[model samples]
Target: MIVAHWPPISATLCPKFSGHVNKPLKGLRSFTFNSSFSFKASFRCYCIKNENPNKISSEEGFSVLGSDIPWDSGSIWSTMAFYFFSLHIPFSFGGLSVVAQILHQPVIDPQTEALSILTLQTLELIGALLLLNYTAKPGYRFSVFRDVIINLGMSKRPQDRHAVGWSSPTAVNNPILKEILLSSNVSEIACILVYCIVTPLLEETVYRGFLLTSLASTMKWQQAVIITSAIFSAAHFSGENSLQLFIIGCVLGCSYCWTGSLSSSIVIHSLYNALTLTITLLS
Candidate 1:
């Protein structure tokens, strides 16, 4: 059972406990209990508070994963559309272009260009996050990001197990990550930041965190994953990387599903992006 709430961008994954109290469940980071949640049960246990270490240990990992996502599929589509345009339109034909024209900016190396691109992307990320919460909850911000960070257990932790799971069943490359290795376009420190940090965080938040879980509420998590991945690939376009993007989307979907933790998908996404950049830079 996977539950969705807040942006853990509250895009952070929120979890709930099973009917059985004796068994501890995999938990997400702490979130405030409000009417927005589908489950009426209290999740105060997910948070680490001023309580004794004994209590924290007792409540640390109870899961909120299950059915009952509050987001509508229609809203998810609308949000994705808005988010997509925000990413593409500005760079293609808008204020940034006019600014560059007026400034008569000199030709920049790949590194500098990467930095400029990152700046725009950073702004988009901030705006996207705020909009996601504002539109979803009307003046409400969810504790999703903090929750994700908290549950993103260390890789070597003993509790680690298969990521991407059973109830769940679950891009794009103008250039596949494979081709990127030989591109030798590491450019600005911004490029690394964009790919390794920003992209992983942003995209995973939208696709895996928000979209996939929302869809899962209406159908089998597996079917939801497939549909989400198809849309994810299409968003990137039917370029050479279309298949790659689809496959990548599946992997990410699985990671999130199996673990019931956005943190896992995020960590995996970020690391894979980092690896691609590293190999490309080295090559």
Candidate 2:
């Protein structure tokens, strides 16, 4: 009789744990989301502070590969810009694909993308200042830029992940997210004026609109917001100020969550981005 060896099938691939719902962060013990997350339950915990070396051991935080946005069934524009855009490194590279004939360039060049991003960023900043003058509360002046920096996370203190996490959820709740989508408060004239003429449409579409929507599919709403915001900040790596932008990313991500509208997120984002651009341009 001959003995035959067989492969092992592990049942551990899917875990069953207490307090487990079919929600995101399935097995992760640290993340706890009840029906409503109030201001008290949320607190920043630094493993280093507790002297727990085992903490932060999970590699679940950051994503370098790609997010879980559904590329197959989305609009043609989204499929083209977000998914296929990465395949084209050089202009010539995108042109090499068979689909290039029908899709023209087949992908957006990074060079052009970078330039357009900067242009829109600049435009948004100028527009924000103009809009601010008209819309800001009494006694509010551009001079308040200093106060914004101080009150916000732009201070000299070290980066706090807790602050980032708390601030990051704001993307969902912002006012501007509402203004563009469901609000008849502003006229269609105002909507088109901001969405098209004054604001940088492509920037918001790519960063908050497209990317956030994409990531939310794969990640828990919280994780998706954080990851998208990080990418948003890191994509502007040329400024030699990644930390600042990453922190800003947290704020934007949080705003998106608080509002649940990309429009609101974009409005907040446009204001913040424009402010940063102005400061950088002036400096």
Candidate 3:
């Protein structure tokens, strides 16, 4: 039986098949059953698994392409794993914020309240960095800062290039953002410093580093990027402004794809967040 399918396998599956992988059919273009030869050729080698003479070798196999792509079928399990186990930034930050609110006044003073917010944010940021470094494989360990900048200048989009780099740019250009960026004051400056120092490192790792990469493994780059960006945006829902939080999530997601450097994205993210926080504090 010979199975002929267009693009026998998806481009994303290329990486898994390229090397000696534990997964079956790891790196072959397609599967074909030749009863006469009764042999299987994969990678650069040929293997002969004994076959029954009575078996119909002409049994047709389905194509692994089109909407039925294997990567898109059930790869979401990996994404969920990373969301909870590796990239816990969203969960951590949300938990901290809730804790802050619940413990406010009763267990903490005004000064302590501010300090706790800062502390929680700081811990979340650290966890994001550590998660990216430790959880992701080295082959995929991209720098959010460097990679994102490079991507911006590149002529090709990830979808066009047949590569699932990261999530799309969820940040929309808003006039208010410009105004926010332009304003500056002392308290705003302090907030900006904290934001600039914290967000990029933390957010990028959580959204792009862990979430994007994990989703990309099972889903197409486009689908993975969209899903991850949604989750990233959702994490900020507890904040007062849902619209702005989603915008920030998109921007951070795109920044990661464009730069590929977790650190660089952190820098840019930190700067943006700091500016916003500063403006909020000063206003």
Q: RMSD, each candidate, Å?
A: 22.1, 25.6, 20.9
Instruction: Score residue 177 of candidate 2 by CA lDDT.
Output: 29
Q: Tens digits of per-residue lDDT for model 3 on 74-170?
A: 5345644564554354434344345545665323333333334345556545554444444344553455333433432111000000011111112
- Per-candidate TM-score against the hidden true structure: 0.58, 0.33, 0.45
Task: Score residue 246 of candidate 1 by CA lDDT.
Answer: 85
What lDDT would each prediction earn against the true structure?
0.54, 0.38, 0.44
Q: After superposition, how far is residue 146 of candidate 1 from its true place, in Å?
A: 5.4
- What is residue 231's positional error in candidate 3, in angstroms? 0.2
**Candidate 2 Cα errors over 4 Å, as ranges:** 1-200, 277-283
Best model number under TM-score: 1
Tens digit per residue, CA lDDT, model 1, 1-283: 3444532221222254342233324564545553543543333344344656555332223323465553545687787778767753453224344445555753333343444456655665566566556555422246543443354321110000011110100121213222323334564355566666666666676777778878876667778789988887766544655677788889988878877877777777677766655654454
- On lDDT, the candidate that comes out on top is 1
Between prediction 2 and prediction 3, which has the larger TM-score?
3
In candidate 1, which residue ranges exceed 4 Å CA deviation?
Answer: 1-65, 88-99, 138-140, 144-188
Least well predicted 10-residue stretch by lDDT in candidate 3: 154-163
